[model samples]
Target: MSESPISHLKFSTILSKLRAGINASDLHGSLTGYLCAGGKATEDTWGEALALDFTAEGIQDNPAFPQFFRQTRAQLDDVEFGFVPMLPADAAALETRAEALVDWCRGFLGGVGLAGAGKRGNELSADAREIVKDFATIASSNLDVSGKEEDETALVEVIEFVRVGVLLLHSELAPASSPRPATSPTSRSLH
Candidate 1:
């Protein structure tokens, strides 16, 4: 599989520079989750995803920013009833990879909540509920990958589970129409 544009943008470094509490994966995941729940992600919405109540700066000036943001939005919009977003996770060390995976899952769940998952949490199907619960568990994973072959394999599988799980949650929660309900939450933006 080819890498995402996000593949090279070190999320940890970005968060550090911005002094952001949320990492890139979680921020993007939140945006993806919010959109899947049928919430619009505008510039203001982006601020909410940042979570510290601070505005995301420099994006409008960065030439690559538009494509990156648009690609994420476009993929999440795909419910071909099949497509999954091509997110980034390419750490060199097993331990780092594990951390990134946990960050991704944690972000995804946070995104879901920001999009009003609780309001309709009870509406989730049996399969969906199981998936959501699984993500919560993965978010707190404490693994010692130490270059063990089995551990490496398990990491791959867990990451795959998250990829598919996000799509499942999006599919299950997405509304049926283009029109937003009168009380639906507004947008939450991301990079």
Candidate 2:
């Protein structure tokens, strides 16, 4: 996949641009979670769901946000999202970086709950359940990547893992769009 448009953005910058105080990961997770959970098509419902986490801000109606929503949907709907999960590459402080990741996972799980992913059958697939459990573990556990090289390696691996799991779940939950059948033309009669 092409280098993600969002790759250049530091997690902080993304949050600012989106006018959302929530961590970038969580915001992304919420959006993805809602879509995967079979949330409705109305943009308002998506906005409201995001608001469940940030009541006051409520996902601004500004151009950037719409663009973000559009882009996110496109990514998910296309070949696959590649699941970057909104972590910052340049965060100088390890703790801060870890905190952002944890917040993101928390937000993602919250989004899943809000979207009611498993509410239908009251069950999540085994794979999905494992993924959720992993996310929960990641959210609560300490992140120590060891040395610089190892940290980079670990981060890359985790990103890949998260991307794959999310994509699989998305595919399972959100059916691809199909063309609408042509409607029959109205009959006209002349005397």
Candidate 3:
């Protein structure tokens, strides 16, 4: 399907709407459960933080995509973000920097993939799900997922759910283009 003419709408707005629609209380409760179940490193906290931030901030900058970066940073912070306590060159900072790069790349790719899918249609496509899966994989790889860890699986699922949910919400909220007026000077010009 042709891309909807919803140029005036912002993707951030759509994401916020979708996040708001979700059961936050339920999500938080679930996260707590996961955390109690040894999923300390799960991304649920980060996802919650980022989703909240997105709702609070909306889209500050559109073309520059600062909202996206800012929201991404919010999520990153929950993961001991950017090596918080020290300046660059410290081991923690170095790890944070590396992680940030990976996270940013994954986030961008997921966003782009979602946007492409949105342009194509309203319904979620397999390709779109694959893109989200790729996002989850990237997030999972950040930790030790090779050992059959339950925490890792839970974390990845949360991240993917948030990503997909955000994309789906944004597309749903996009506004249809304004309808053009029915009459024009040319229409009345005929003698």
Candidate 4:
């Protein structure tokens, strides 16, 4: 019943204006993934980790992105388990929302990979490994929906699983209290 920490519509509009070539859900997922993998929670570091060229014309100094970045970091660090992926509202079509979830998972996987989480695979607990595996499957699966109530319920369950899984990853991977340096953004391809 609480309002979403970030408004998907407003965030999506900001991305559209910036021509960021990514949806809001995916971007938020990437941010979450990066943070979970111990990346610094700064606009520059996030952009660098994701290889996003914020210096490109209108992308730099965008007021919305910094707010989004801070809000996501706070949600992940919140003790009350408030983290949620930025996806379409429940009023949206089931298929549309599902696709966004898929995109979000993909982005999350990419972010973790970029943050060198793969190198720490041996350190992850069994549950964390399973969570990563499940996220990978979700990211790759072609979810076919019939718009049935059961299908909606299943989607909700999967989303909740993702939310908890991310929290686990963050707790296990992020350093206890170390400051990370911000890397310079490069022109590498995100794919």
Query: Highest lDDT among the candidates is held by which one?
Result: 4
Using lDDT as the yardstick, the better of models 1 and 2 is 1
Q: Per-residue lDDT of 84-116 in model 2, one digit per residue for the tens?
A: 566666545555666667777777777777777
Against the true structure, what is every candidate's RMSD? 7.8, 12.9, 20.0, 8.0
**Candidate 1: C-alpha lDDT:** 0.61
Model 1 lDDT tens row, 35-145: 666555564445555354454675434434344456566565554533343334545777877776677777777777877876887898766777778878877767667
Clashing pairs in 3: none
Better of 1 and 4 by TM-score: 4
| Local accuracy by lDDT, each model | 0.61, 0.60, 0.33, 0.80
Full ranking by TM-score: 4, 1, 2, 3
lDDT, candidate 2, equals 0.60
Instruction: Give me candidate 4's TM-score against the actual structure.
Output: 0.87
Better of 2 and 3 by TM-score: 2
The candidate with the higher TM-score, 1 or 3, is 1
Candidate 2 Cα outliers beyond 4 Å, as residue runs? 1-11, 17-19, 42-45, 52-61, 80-83, 90-96, 120-122, 176-191
Please write out the lDDT profile of model 3 over residues 93-125, one tens digit for every residue.
334433433454344443333334334434544
TM-score of each: 0.74, 0.71, 0.23, 0.87
Give the residue spans of candidate 3 off by over 4 A: 1-97, 102-122, 143-191
Give Cα distance to truth, residue 23, candidate 3, Å.
Answer: 24
**Root mean square deviation (Cα) for candidate 1:** 7.8
